[model samples]
Target: VLGLGNVGPLAGKPVMEGKALLFKRFADIDAFDIEVQARDAGHLIDVVAAIAPGFGGINLEDIAAPVCFEVEETLQAMLDIPVFHDDQHGTAVIVAAALQNALELQGKELGRIKVAIVGAGAAGIAIARMLRALGVADIFLSDLHGVLHSGRRDLTQWHKPFAVAPQDWDLAAMLRGADVVIGVSVRGAIPEAALPMLAPKPVIFALANPDPEIDPAVARRLRPDAIIATGRSDMPNQVNNVLGFPFLFRGALDCRARQINQPMLLAAVDMLARLAREPVPDAVQAAYGLTATQGLAFGPEYIIPKPLDPRLRQRVSGAVTVAARESGVARR
Candidate 1:
């Protein structure tokens, strides 16, 4: 995690603590957090490359983008071990999984949806790419300045593909009639009044960490038809990357996979979506201390599996394991 901070031992990105506390708790894989002080992308890449042999895989956490892309792509290309940038792919996997189920509950199709992603950083860029792969044609992305459009000369390779017409330059403008508003930007990026501009039954994923762009409670109040998800656990439909990374790495390691490819990622996504549709297990309900009346079953409130769901280890890991073997990326 290049953005590793000294605020505390657990300081980094969201859920940043020695590869997260849940890695061992959920997947039974020994995980530790390593904070590195490096000069540049070359230094960062060298550090991981030197340490690559000590682990089955490397998860790039909290590393900021533009640089994140360089560091990760370089490491992945050079290392036999699967080099995963959780901020980019793991976040994308969870967001996509949650959106699949959310849109399903909302009676919407992926191909017909209009998505506005606020935050053109690594997570936002990866989400846009994954959604495009999922058949979403209309997508607009916004950065700190404004939307990525033809009028912007500062756009990079990552931002260029998702760029749309300059018709909508801001969050409020881009969200008009949009079927989804995915906020990976900073907190409060999505104004409370801007949510009303969305199309009916909009799937809103305010996935910014610590605090989301829009509070889930406020989103629910503003649009009863809205299916809202946040990065917060206290909220319904929490789009936690924990739901993706641990299981993903567990399965990839189980198979001795060479890389965490797109097929394996999409496999995890489908597994998550399907698992949410199944009856909530007693253990899962108990883990959350949810009563029967709380409705643990799949709905707008439960579009993705709980991060603590015991089945995630078997189901998501198994799916990725199978995908790894099928994709011919596994050694064993």
Candidate 2:
């Protein structure tokens, strides 16, 4: 089952329907999407409880942050089945994959990389935490209020874990020596002037939807060697959550996972990066009706898998379920 809050104009139904189709195709799991409205947490819980009997797991999508945090917490405490908020975790998983791939291409170890994230909201924080868990060195995060350094006076409890002591810094100063810069915030946060400050040929993932923090054309023009990606499909290295959710939920469903933990997410990321380095498999080739023996290659222009590329979910789901079983999070 899927639970969503106030899908605008019913335009969002197609997205849930697409998920259902993918679930049927890849995992053979049947899913129903429901639009929900609630004045408070209690209403959400009551609505979910009314329909919980039919679903093996619940996927929460497109809900805004902070409220999303509360909603997931409420559902987890109340429901017997596993509950996942795909926006928070799904986006994190795919970004983790992109980061890993970027690091690999650079011949750098994950532990030695210095990173900066431009957005400190749910997706940005989740990505930073997961990267830290994977042993990334020195991840600096900033939001609209500027750097999320320690004791800035406006820090929330959620942003506190990532707070560092202020260092008289600006975004360009932080980007000067960082190995990677990720943009999850608003457009044009990372100005073109900052492009040259990156640690010689740094990997840049400007992932804001519609318009990225740094314009892709501008970044490519200024620093011709930088690796760049965005959240839009028209651009190269599109880091769409569409690439993540179907496979991830498919894995959870296949294993009857009790939770979608860090280990499972990490596993999914690893496989996704590795898949981009090789040829598309027979099954995927047949599914896409393609005759090409070689799969998508990894490079500046192709840091991530295309969303329409049929090979993604099969490979990603297999890896995630394997990790779930190993991590003892799988019920099956």
What are the Cα lDDT values of the candidates? 0.87, 0.78
Question: Model 1, which residues run further than 4 Å from truth?
Answer: 1-20
Location of the lowest summed lDDT over 10 successive residues in candidate 1: 1-10
- Candidate that would win on lDDT: 1
Residue pairs of candidate 1 with colliding backbone atoms: 18-33
Tens digits of per-residue lDDT for model 1, 1-332: 32233343235534456466778888988887777777788998999899889999998877777889999888889999899998899999999998999999999999998999998999999999899888899988999989899878998877888877766477678888999999988778998888888898888898777778887788889998898888888878888888998999999999999999999999999999999999998877887887766759889889999887889999999999999999999999
Backbone clash pairs for candidate 2 read: 150-164, 279-295, 280-295
Against the true structure, candidate 1 has what lDDT?
Answer: 0.87
In candidate 1 the C-alpha lDDT for residue 4 amounts to 32
Worst 10 residues of 2 by lDDT: 1-10
